[model samples]
Target chain A: SAVISQKPSRDICQRGTSLTIQCQVDSQVTMMFWYRQQPGQSLTLIATANQGSEATYESGFVIDKFPISRPNLTFSTLTVSNMSPEDSSIYLCSVVSFGEAFFGQGTRLTVV
Target chain B: AQTVTQSQPEMSVQEAETVTLSCTYDTSESDYYLFWYKQPPSRQMILVIRQEAYKQQNATENRFSVNFQKAAKSFSLKISDSQLGDAAMYFCAYGGSGSARQLTFGSGTQLTVLP
Candidate 1:
């Protein structure tokens, strides 16, 4: 099992500003996933970050809005840029190791 | 593309009783994995159980169990001796093998444990 820690557990951001959420794992992992959960909605995959390459984003999400950086095997960062009220949601980081997936506590962002 | 569906939006069960949460998925691949995750008010997603499509026997963990029907592409979770802590939002997920292991999540089912 892997333990993950996400920074800025909860944040309130102003519109047009950007907030970067950091995810650090206790051990090295190959694939890291980013997800977004709107209020009263299911989670949607934002992107998949692997070390030494660009992240693969899902449909309806663009890097211009959510840029990801995976500098190493154990760490990654996701930046929510040009935030809006609609961007107010919970962001989660997940890692797959040994065939099992684990998730971080998640960051709750409220854009005003 | 694979999709998961959870028909139940909300359900209530008395303490020490049993409750079942329904989940079904659509996938073209023959081999895949299904999972049931629990999210409490803390917002942490905890994996409650998992079942591989090839496995004929159902998977069980403590008080939680699954009824995985491969032909029907259905995986339902049954919780016995329900406790107050069991109250939370339950999500069903489906994922493929190796390079195709991206998870597709269901809408979710909000469970209330009545005292």
Candidate 2:
């Protein structure tokens, strides 16, 4: 299992503003995933970040709205651009390796 | 594509009692894995138990055990002698065996242990 550190743990941003969440893994992993959980809702996959390549976004999510960057195997960033009130949710980053997946503490974003 | 389902949205158990959480998954891949994760209010996900598909024997960890029904695509978690520390959200997850390790998680069941 790998430990993941995510920051800013939480933030309150204006509707027009943007926020970038960073996730760093203790060890190298082949796949990293970003997920969003709306209040009292299930987790939804945003995208899959592969090191040194463009991230693969899930259906209903676009690269422009949630751009992802994986500079290396141990680091990835997810940027929520042109945010809106609907973007208010908890964003979690998870790393997958050796048949196991470990998640970060998660970033709680509130867009007002 | 795989989908995990947790029928109960919330459950309550008295301290020192046992409770079971039901989970069912729909997947075409035979070589997959099931997992149970606990998320406290702190929002950090912790692995509680996991069951490998190939193994016929169920997995047990100290006070937690899983009844895996491969044929029925069902996996249920049983927590024995529940404690206040077990009050949290439990999520059932499924993943494939190969390079794709992305886990499909069910809608979590919020467990509250009454003391």
Candidate 3:
């Protein structure tokens, strides 16, 4: 089992500003996943952060828009750069432990 | 790419009754996993149950069970003896076999347990 802690459970940000969400896992993992859940929508994969290498983003997401940093095996951060109202959503980090996927308490970001 | 589809947008069940949420997926991978997750008002996603494609027998966890029809690509979750605490948004997800097993989620179904 994995216990994940996410900071700033919810935050209101001004448009054009950036907010970085942090995720700390209980144990070290080889790869971590980042997801975005827009209002009234299902979760979508933003990127996969692998320690010692760059993060791999999904088709609609790009590095510039959502830069991720995996400084170590147990920690990762996702930054939503130049936020917009459309970017207001819940951000969740996930990892696989014992073949089960565990998620952090999502960070709800509201961009004004 | 794998896609999960939950046809039911909303469902209600009387307390102590049963409810089933529908889910269908499209994936070419023969080896994969199916999951049902419950997200409450707190936005914490809790894994309700899981089923493996290789398992022919259905997967059950206390009041939660799945009717997994691999050939039909359908996996439905049945919640028995529903309680008020069961009210939440239920999401069906598909995770193919891999290291990370990146998940593809369905739209979601809001389950309301009526007293």
Candidate 4:
């Protein structure tokens, strides 16, 4: 299984501030996914990012609000822009290979 | 489009007992993959088991096993001799074969294992 290192692990930011979460995989993967798991809620797909191209955001999610960057096969970043209290959630980065998927430990964000 | 459904929002089972979590999904693809992921209080996403739509035999790993019915589009997870560590939120996910193989997850079922 591939090991994913995600940071800052957690953060507390004031409303209207923005935060960027980074995910680093131990190995190279073509595509990486970003997901948001709200407090006591299920995981929602934010976007699918591919190396060297634009990311595809899911319905109800926008590139302006949740921008994703995949600079290379092993690194990707998701930025939550203009954060609000509602933006508080655990952000996860994941990759799938050979019918199995691996996820990062997740970044827990709290906006007040 | 694919949608995974987990009818039970929460469930409880006595330690060392057996419990099954139900899951059903809707998809048009003939070949795909179904997965059961466990998220504990630590919030790490752990893959419990996986079943291929093309395979008729169920998939199992230790005490965790899946009952997969391809025609009914049903996949269920059964944990035998459950332990306290089994308590967590369980999510059922679906992924179709493609370049953009993103997983569609269920709402999730919170399992409580009582000691």
lDDT of 4: 0.94
Residue A58 in candidate 4 has what lDDT? 91
Q: What DockQ class does candidate 2 belong to?
A: medium
List, residue by residue over B1-115, the lDDT tens digit for candidate 3: 8889999999999999999999999999999989999999899999999998999999999999999999999999999999999999999999877676678899999998989
Per-residue CA lDDT of candidate 4, range A6-108, in tens? 9999999999989999999999999999999999888999999999999999999999999999999999999999999999999999999876788999999
DockQ of every candidate: 0.59, 0.74, 0.69, 0.68
Candidate 4, residue B41: CA error in Å?
0.8
Give the residue spans of candidate 2 off by over 4 A: none
Residue by residue across B11-65, what tens digits does model 1's lDDT show? 9999999999999999999987889999999999999998888889999999999
Q: Model 3: what TM-score for its first chain?
A: 0.98
Judged by DockQ cut-offs, the docking class of candidate 4 is: medium
Worst ten-residue run, lDDT, model 3 chain A?
A95-104
Docking class of 1: medium
DockQ value of candidate 4 = 0.68
Model 1, position A1: C-alpha lDDT score: 91
RMSD of each: 1.0, 0.8, 0.9, 0.9
Q: What is the lDDT of candidate 1?
A: 0.93
lDDT of 1 by residue, A9-99 (tens): 9999999999999999999888899999999889999999999999999999999999999999999999999999999999999987644
**What DockQ results for candidate 1?**
0.59
lDDT of 2 by residue, B15-90 (tens): 9999999999999998988999998989888999999999999999999999999999999999999999999999
lDDT of 3 by residue, A16-111 (tens): 999999999999999899999998888999999999999999999999999999999999999999999999999999998655789999999999
lDDT at A9 for candidate 3?
94
